[model samples]
Target: MNVVCIGSGYVGSVTGTAFAVLGHPTTVIDIDPSKIDLLNAGKSPIYEPGLDQLVRKYIGKTLFATTSYQPVHEADVVFIGVGTPSKQDGTADLTYIKKAAELIGAYLHPHRFTVVVNKSTVPVGTADLVTAIIEEASGLKAGEHFSVVSNPEFLREGYALEDVFFPDRIVVGSNHERAKNIMRELYHRLVERVSYEEISKDFAFPYNPLTPKAVYFETDVKSAEMIKYASNAFLAVKISYINEVARLCETLGANVLDVARGMGLDSRIGGKFLQVSSGWSGSCFPKDTAEFLQTSRKYGTELSIVKAAIESNRKMHEFVVEKIRRRLKILNGKKIGILGLTFKPNTDDARQTQASVIIQMLLDLGANIRVHDPKGMEMFKAVHPHLHVQYCASAEDVAHQADGIVLLTHWNEYLQLDWKQMLSIMKTPYLLDTRNFLPKKLLIGLGYQYEGLGIGTEQEIDGGIMNQFSVLSV
Candidate 1:
């Protein structure tokens, strides 16, 4: 199959490269000249482990990048991956999708039956809209000349190539039998593999241990689109639920880690998104939840739980700031260090990250902030250039002369930081583990006053740590 992927960000860059590796001649289309040049030069414009390696191996052989949509006429499958960023009122801004669809329609061959796959996460009725637009632009019937598919992506950042090569499930949503068959043939390598035993023997199937084979689910277009939104929104709600539980655990003097582990041990409750953190903020969750809520309202329904999750997520950031305020009674002129900036580790994406909100709160309180991340600092600075933060070169630099330190994203290297040296350098040895990701016993032993969220009576459980609030009694 000659695959043409629209857009060159995370989705197109990784997926297209994987397709070329899977023996499909893939061409990535991007409007940005720099992105196209990077792809052609055997470098991925976005950060995904091993993606550039794959691109380099197949660059001019079976993989290509270009700004022109002229190759659409020859493509058997064309995937639309344009951005659907959230609008002000929580509705998806479909401006990019519209333009991509228009260009695809204009360049579509009259005789070529292109399987137009909606690779971007979108609303339920998006496939129909795309079909209508293509029909009007190309002067051809949809099923006769082309077909639209709702094939939403489920790739996680930091582990994109692994997920692509060894997917647990592949979904194709379209009414046309021909289009579904074409998609099946396109993904036959993974879906119709030799045996379930072959895949299980390697990974132990940690992603989906219960599933045997990588199931190629065939469903209606609307259902396929809903699956992506519902799955992401459910995970977001699950994260918020645990954070709520963690808050309650703090009041009741219970260890959240133990409670979460007990809850996860249940076969029904399965622990994927149960970790307590500053809150869920990433490229997908915040945007998708808002759009899901907006779509529900547009069709005369309401998702009250999602609304609460959004509000709770905002409060989670405030909750972290309040804990900092309680520790340092006055935040003015305090030098605080932040360990990580990306939503999670191993990806350079800084979109809608929790660090932005937490840092803004510290800045508002007149605190001087220093931050460091192994891969996310460049992206964080690009998105939040207005934020007055010192971009430290290393974790030790962030800790230098700092009054307190907060570990937000649990990068692996943070585990090996010289805590004793950090404590020695810091003006005040106060440390808060926002994700509960660091070693509390070691930090406490190292003479730094260690704090973690929802540990057994560590915070706000019995009137503050060691009667520190007793001084506030008036």
Candidate 2:
């Protein structure tokens, strides 16, 4: 099968590369000529683990990248993996998806029957919109030469390769039987191979396979689109709920780690997203949750809890900043050190990152900032060059001559550093573990004052509880 993925970004590139590895001839298209050139040269535009290796393995043979839209008519399957970013009012901007459909329509060959798959996370009724746009542009009636399906992607950044190779479930949303069968066959080999490997590590393949492999759940297009938004919205709600609980735990003399562990062991609640931090950030959760709420409003329904979660998360960044201000007394002349700048670990993406927000707030308060990130300094410097900040080579360099240190991101490199050596160079040995990635016992043993969200010592328990409760109530 020939598969063409539009918008060769993080999702499109990974999805196209995976299909190519599965023996399908895959072409990834993008309007950015530079990005396409990089991909065609066997180099990835984004920073993802295992992606470069996969691109190199199938670069010229099975996988190809281009800036032209002519490949849309050459493939039996076309996946629309463009970005639908959130607008100011929280609605998903479908301009890119619309343009991609128009481009695909203009170049589609009349003889070829193509299955247009909506791989981008979109509104519920977007598949119908895409169908209409394609029909209008191609001047062809529906079901004559083309069909639309919603096959939403559920990939995470750090573990995207692993998730693609072994997904929790494969969802195919289409009404036509022929389109469904072809889609199933495209993934049938991978599904059977995975099952065979699971049952027997060294399983032998039959020369002529007779039985049809069943691996995907077939549903309508609307449900599949809803599944992607619902899944991301629920995870966002979970993170916000835990952060709210962490705020309460700070005052009640209760350890959030213990409480989260006890709650997570219930099986129904699960242990994911229970760890408290400076709230959720990155590309998916924040924008998707807002879009979900906006969609709810459009349908004359209110997702009150989800709305509260979004608002609370926005305030959580300020909450971390407030903690720093209270400790240092004044920020005008204080030199603060920030450990990590990316939204999370293992990626260089800084979109909607809490570190950016907190750093901006500190600068507004007239503080001198020194920052260090394992892999995000170059990206961070691009956006925040005018601020009174210095980017250092290592965490120790940033910590030197600083009155306080803030751990905004929980990168493994930050965790592996020597806490004693980092504290030794600081003007004041005050450490704020926003993500709770520090060893409390070790920090205190080194004679440095340690603080974390919802993790307080016995003295803080008595002195801070009343004050926290009073503030929370207000």
Candidate 3:
């Protein structure tokens, strides 16, 4: 299958690259010539594990990238994998999607039956909107010449390749049977793969260990769009719920880790997004939740729990700042080191990251800030150039001469940091584990004042390291 993906952003690049890896002739198109040049030079525009290597391997083989839509007429399938960024009013900004649709329409073959897939996360009826736009621009009827399919992507940032290759499920939502069949044929290799035991006997499916094959779910177009938003909204709620539990644990002197462990063991509540933190802020969760709420409002419906979850997440970041304010008593002229800048670890995305929000709050309180991240420094600096922050080379560099340290993103590298060395460099060895990722007893034993989210108890439990938090319900 010849696949042409429009808008070579995160989704476009990953999706196009994956299609090319599957032996399809894939061309990724973007408006930015620089992004296309980077892709053509065997480099990925965004930071994703295994993306650069894949791009390098397939650049001249099966993968191509361009800034023009001239190849659309030759494509069997054109995927609009553009970014549908959220507007300030909390609605999805569909400018990019609309433009891609118009361009696809302009270059679409007049007689060929091309399947246009909407890989971008969009609101309901967007496929219909794209269909209408394409029809208007191409002067060809949608059902006769081309059809639109709502195939929402569920790729995670850090593990996009893994998610694409071994997805839990592949959803294709369309009314046109021909279009659906085309999509099925396009993804046949992934869905209908040979037995893993025959290929790599020792290899394991790390994501879905028990599942042998990824499920294929076919649904209506509108429902497919809702699935993406609902999925992220539910995860956001779980995160916010855990943070609320952490707050209760703080008040009741309980351990949230134990609580989560006990709850996760239940077959009904198998854990995935239950990690307690300073709220959920990322490209997907925050924007999707906001859009979901906005859609509900437009439909004259209310999602009270979702509203509360959003509020709780906002307050959670403020809670981290409050902990520092309470410990130091004076924010002005106080030097603090912040660990982690990205919203999540293992990816260099800094859009709507919690670290930025917390840093801004700290700055507002007149605290001197120094930040460090393994991969997010360049992106963080690029995103937040207006703020005056000391971008350090390493975690210890950020900690040096600081009065306090706050662990924001739960990056694995932070786990291996020399805590005692960090203590030696800091003016005051006060640590706030906002993600509750560190060992409480180990830090306390090192003569450093350690505070973890929802950890109020000072003593160890069951002869093990002390851990604490448990439940928030609507």
Best candidate per lDDT, number? 3
Pairs in steric clash, model 2: none
Question: Model 1 off-target regions past 4 Å?
Answer: 193-211, 457-474
Q: Clash pairs of candidate 3?
A: 255-468, 255-469, 256-468, 256-469
Q: How high is the CA lDDT of each candidate model? A: 0.85, 0.82, 0.86
Q: Against the true structure, whose TM-score is highest?
A: 3
How accurate locally is residue 11 in candidate 3, as Cα lDDT from 0 to 100?
93
Determine the backbone clash count of candidate 1: 0
The alpha-carbon lDDT assigned to residue 466 of candidate 3 equals 26
The whole-model C-alpha lDDT of candidate 2 against the native structure comes to 0.82
What's the best-to-worst order under lDDT?
3, 1, 2
lDDT of 2 by residue, 340-456 (tens): 888888787776788888999999998999999888888788866666689898787888888999998888676567776777788999888887766555566676778988765
Deviation from native of the Cα of residue 462 in model 1, angstroms: 22
RMSD (Å) of each candidate, 1 decimal: 5.7, 6.8, 4.6
Q: After superposition, how far is residue 336 of candidate 1 from its true place, in Å?
A: 0.7
